[model samples]
Target: MPVRTSPADAPLRIAVVADSDTRWKWGALTARRIAGRPPELAGFLLRGRATPTPRQLAEVGVAADALREVTMAEFLRAAEREPYDVVVLALVGGAAQAALHGLARLWPGHARRPVLVTGYVGVVYEKLADGLLLRHGADVVLANSRHDAERFRAVYEGVGADAAAVTEAALPFLGGAPHTPEPGRDTVVFAAQPSVPESRADRMYLLRRLIGHARRHPERDVLLKLRSKPGEHTTHIEEQPYQKLARSLDPPPNFRLVYGNMGEVLDRTDLLVTVSSTAALESLHRSVPTAVLTDLGVREALGNHHFIGSGCLASWDQLDAGHRPSPDPRWLAAQGVAPGEAYEGAFDAVRARLAELLARPALAPVSPYYTPVTAPGYLPGILARHHLAPDGTPLPGAAPETEATGVRRLVRDAVRDAARGAYRHGVQRVAPVIRRMGEL
Candidate 1:
């Protein structure tokens, strides 16, 4: 396949559309890693329920050449108007599918279109088939590990969809100095997830155990690495925030809540613990002694089940007894955590694939597996939720609005915050009460 090489005067122009803080970090970092050269990178934050605030963006700390927020329709319009060589859809499956169809419609038959890329932010433990099918049309669907790439291809091939799109690549944000044991102060960082243990009781139990561990090891620093503040949203809705729950408990002086880059925290970390956060992969990549808690069982719902054979699973009791589990070398390699040269070349294949796609004169239209024809009963609703028509056009009153300013912008911000607060309340408080009432 012929590879397109941009002229010396012109750098590759790449666009990344992402929702939520985690996806933004993944998308922005991935763009830079795959650019090969210092490409002109543009970032568009999908303005919706999970859009990260400025504070969240700062905490994640990944930056682009230019960054702005856009609705789905606005993004499609921008893609049509701009000359981006590659467009990464760093969004949820449904949003990605909608964008794929929309782009296909806008650049119909023999028209030049950007090389589309889509993928998960981390471990895929649920909706495997559903998510893969939704992302089927992209030029590349990145898999953070060889294990994920294999599974992604199998799902596509099993359903008779093209599996060539599945590309094996390591997580872009997985680089840091190798772990070195800190003298005197052994820091134990428990990476908290937004919704792994969805129930309040479960979250509280984990918090109590963390407190117990801190008490047991008074000389050590026990940090709860929280994802977001109470009012902020993330990739998943955080119902029972550890911050709120921690306020109710009397934790030791050594025990404290922390918010910052996970990599920075891992710099001093002797042990990294989590139910299941992508932070585990980052920790493993840096050779930090890591543990996936088995106190809550290796259940699929909790996502720790993905690490069942990783050899990193241990109970809090085991950790308390100074048992630092070492991950299986084979498991680490398979999960794209290979050391030295092997890890460095993890994205080679995908980069080559992107170059080849870019070289094509007139690429084929985006053809996702789930269309109005293939999934008549399902696809429309998904599109409609994003205010998109089945054909990928924005619905009435859904066209991109001009950027609001001054009083109007303030009102919009206020309204959005209130809505998010209400949603969090429903998830944390009302839903549990309803469930209890149903049980009664």
Candidate 2:
């Protein structure tokens, strides 16, 4: 008998594990767009458990009625009972890799798993998870950065990712309409997100200090703008909560919490300010001055000079003195990427690749997920050449064989070592769902 057709009937099962509300919002949007409709949807919020608020529901068109608060374990159980066609997992921070373990435990007996949509957060955790998921089951690993894609293949699980299947995508802004240009106004801007949580604490502090400096220096018209993408595009309002909080005291004439067209705001601006946002990198291509405010966490995560060379990373004192915050604009263009270009091309490529990889001729059901490595016995050997001992033990006594190697030699060794190490001592097992930041 011929079956009736409906977008909801043959929907792909997408499970998102996100570290923040924003990522989850975007992940859910992407899933609905790709999968079609309500009945076919399955999503898991990595953090908050509950249905979307009224505004949240309206923001994404998710049927609040259809949304469920199922745990990772519960989602997995349901997935097995009615086998989803694909699973999209959006993750960030420390929670991403852990979420995969939760998923693996649920499907303890399934053989052929669904296609996975991965949105990884940091380079460190992505590698940790990639080694695991690729070795065990994931059919596809969607990374947000080419660097991350390569890293996943090079170190984590060489065989875990299909080079052809790996698609480098942009970090989606979800629903806010992007900023358009305004006729004539210099509005070079610096972007910081209060919502980024403690991960951006250093940056947050630096921003506050700059605002204080602006109060004293009355000539520079420094604009501090928060990032507002297409999904939740809000008009520039001086009275907004974040702005009110940022500029609690009456600010000086030069400093402002500007709003409206971000593109126009940035395009007209003379300079940009930030810590490690990819936006700072993008502004450089647009020829805006960018500066990075550094502290302990930023220094530890990414070196200062690293972003400075790319543009938009600078010292506040330098910026206060009317000193531009960039060296070469071309370098910025070379490193920075536009979200539209990144998401439209990279993300689409991933979706298409996913469809291709799992096509009938290529499709194969693989595993019931498992994290057998928390204990020493089943641990996958994760041998980082940077710290590998004679017997493959990781420690301070690993001797740092190539830590002091020459530049050319270092690059060569990094490449060579990554491959050799993956083949020799790779042990991390990640869930099929993961992400890579585009800035990498």
Candidate 3:
């Protein structure tokens, strides 16, 4: 069916809440293209606790009216005030997904509610359970590849989501015109993410290995790309900063920690190494030689499993010997990242889907009903981590708790808190150099 709006009708409104740089660029570019100079296009820079800096906004080409900085709560209240036709979310983080659930519950059965469209902003391996939960909250789930779309559908159906909710959409590559390698500047950048449990120990190992490689091949400049600055908050709180970690080790003359303008860095980079970073996909799209570090095993949480059997990933042994890996065409195609293909189809699909949704605003299904044992007034503390009890006073107990159950709960909390404290202590104590190295 055709979109209800004509050229003369009011321009469609879109609200984008981005959690990261890549997702922000994706939303901005897609919204800009779809909106096409007709009128104002509003969006949100939802960076959790961190606000978007002017430098960050300039880098992403986000204009003043194009995107406003807002918290999840503020964004939801705004959605209530002047309803948008669609809301594009970079629902990659836990808090973001949880916020979506909160919004869903808040606006139950609202016929004019905006449709939520989300996708994987990076590698997906063990996150299927979380992805399913996200699907439960969203109206449409965008898949990064045809393979991913199928995978999402199976998971959604398994979780009893509507069959029409999932759709195929390629991950957008906003870097215009892939660059060829410049002669005499052989830069090898290791895109690091230390927040993943599997990568914590292995990340340091890989860095030492990279140092060894850099020492052996002094002609090549090695750069360690970090995610965030020390003491800054990201979606996932990084335990150890690689900068602090690297400070303890003797430095190689050719190696340095590099940050900022990831796309520009990739343009000048000849070889890129990482552990399941979406940057690998971007590198592949740019025809840069890229490798997924397999030092960490293919556990679901580590997300290295996605690269198994794909030639794009290199083993620790392989990278240790200075072997550069190329992405297998078949594997790349399966991941829906083959070159020269129209990556913009995903944006087109989003636009079309939004148009359809706007035409029939009430098409999205209401969530399945559930009966809570506790009353709504007393449920905020249990249901929400961020939402507090009334005036900071604890809510009345839903039911009398047994001694055994209370003790068990206390024990669980104690253990969890202790483990978290130990991890944080290790990270803080070991803060010599080379701290968290991935998101930025």
Candidate 4:
């Protein structure tokens, strides 16, 4: 018999995967930074940009010449030859994972590989409701705050992620600036909008809070604006209560409504107010006050950091009950975090993780597909999620990322009687050809 070399079963392959969108840059940039770190990790980078620059790549503190940028297709083919070390799917949209898993069909032997996933839990702690639903993709989670870490641990283990095996890393450095603001201004300006609202009533309730806040404070003028995030349309903003409140209010406009040219506009603004906004950190470093408002009964997920105090953000009732109106100095300590320094620290932590994962012995993927999803080989729902077609009209000019995937196929399955029915009489021996097909 011809020997089967078992090339499909080998050491883990480490690849940084991401969508084609602009955010993919985060993973690539971070991976590049890691590749340029310590010597042990430099070897595991295997493929990605060599940190620093082409000229600076040589001085990356170690020898790492083999690493280079790779397309998703190229990666799928390469994994067929050797197992991967890790696949970091940084911050990517849901559609990206579908394509990544579909591409996994090209190489079918990595079912048990480790996947480090990072994304919001999409949990909305409304003022008076329980954390509505548990979210996934936070499976192997990397959370920055204590609440997020605890909540995620509860979520993943609830879904069976060998919580013991999962490593929880404290990510003090993962935070980002919402925007730069004027110095020494203590006034609070809230810039926030929840992407997904569970219901219209909940949405309107939050809106009324903002409007009520603005209306009650005869002095302090509040500004309500939407951050200019990519793929967000003004129409989406126009549909919100911010617009409706604008139409409803009489002449004494306490709140200023803003929509476009946000970055420039934010430069002149002071304190930022909202619910656990990444922007609050930006306001902090800029010497502006930030108050994270927790509606009526919602849990305040954004807690006070060692550098920033809880005072920045307040609950709606607290505003009514009267609390000391002062910004937390803890955040002032955060003023020390330089833009470049935080990025460097983040890169260092990531490199350390890569080094630890790659130095260990290799193992075959749980299945031939290193990506998410339980089964491989002619799996349905998995590939169908990719949302691509042979023609690209839905996506405009370019060709579809995927073609006709066809029907799902099954390799093998075992059955047992759940109903206590007449199993002995209902079951029968398979015919010769049918038995042969099963063997085949």
Query: What is candidate 1's CA lDDT for residue 84?
Result: 88
lDDT score of residue 303 within candidate 2:
35
- The model with the greater lDDT, 1 or 4, is 1
RMSD over all Cα atoms, model 1: 2.6
State residue 142's C-alpha deviation in candidate 4, in Å: 2.6
Q: Candidate 1 on 1-440: residue-level lDDT in tens?
A: 12345684477888999989999999888887788877899999988878998999999898888998888888888888788888999999888988888888787676677899999899999999999999989989999998999999999999999998899998988888888775686999999999989888889999999999999999999999999887788988876788988988999999989999988999999999999998998999989999999998999999999998899999999998999999998999999985556778888988899888877887887888988889999999988988899888888877646778999989988997799778878876787779889989
The total of clashing pairs for model 3 equals 18
Q: Write the per-residue lDDT of candidate 3 for residues 38-105, one digit (tens) a residue.
A: 43457776634344445555555555356665545556556666656667776454444545655565
Q: Candidate 1 — which residues are off by over 4 angstroms?
A: 1-9, 400-402, 405-407, 429-440
For 1-440, candidate 2 gives per-residue lDDT tens digits of 11223353465555554333445555665565554344256555432322233354344344322444443344444555655666666544223333344344444443345665655432232235534343334455555455556655664444433344445554443223343444544443666543332333444465577676676555556677754322222211111234435545565667766644344556566666665555554454354556766543345344344453454445666666666654563443233243334334545666666666545433443332323433333323322221322222334643233334478767964775465334322211111112124334
| RMSD of candidate 3 to true structure, Å | 9.5
TM-score of candidate 1 versus the correct structure, residues matched by position: 0.95
Query: CA lDDT of each candidate?
Result: 0.88, 0.46, 0.63, 0.39
Per-residue CA lDDT of model 4 for 1-440, tens digit only, reads 11123333343233444332212333443344445532111122212111122222332222332454333344444444443344445422333344344333432353433343333222223321112111132223344333444654675456454443223333332334444544554343666553323233555665666677777775656676654322222111212334543465442466666654323444666546666544454455444545666553344333222223445656666764555346544433333323334434533544455556444443233222213244333234333433322210112322224432334212111111222122222221123235457778
Residue 301, model 1: Cα distance from true site in angstroms = 1.1
Order of candidates by TM-score, top first?
A: 1, 3, 2, 4
Backbone clash count for every predicted candidate, in the order shown: 0, 36, 18, 30
TM-score of each candidate?
Answer: 0.95, 0.58, 0.77, 0.48
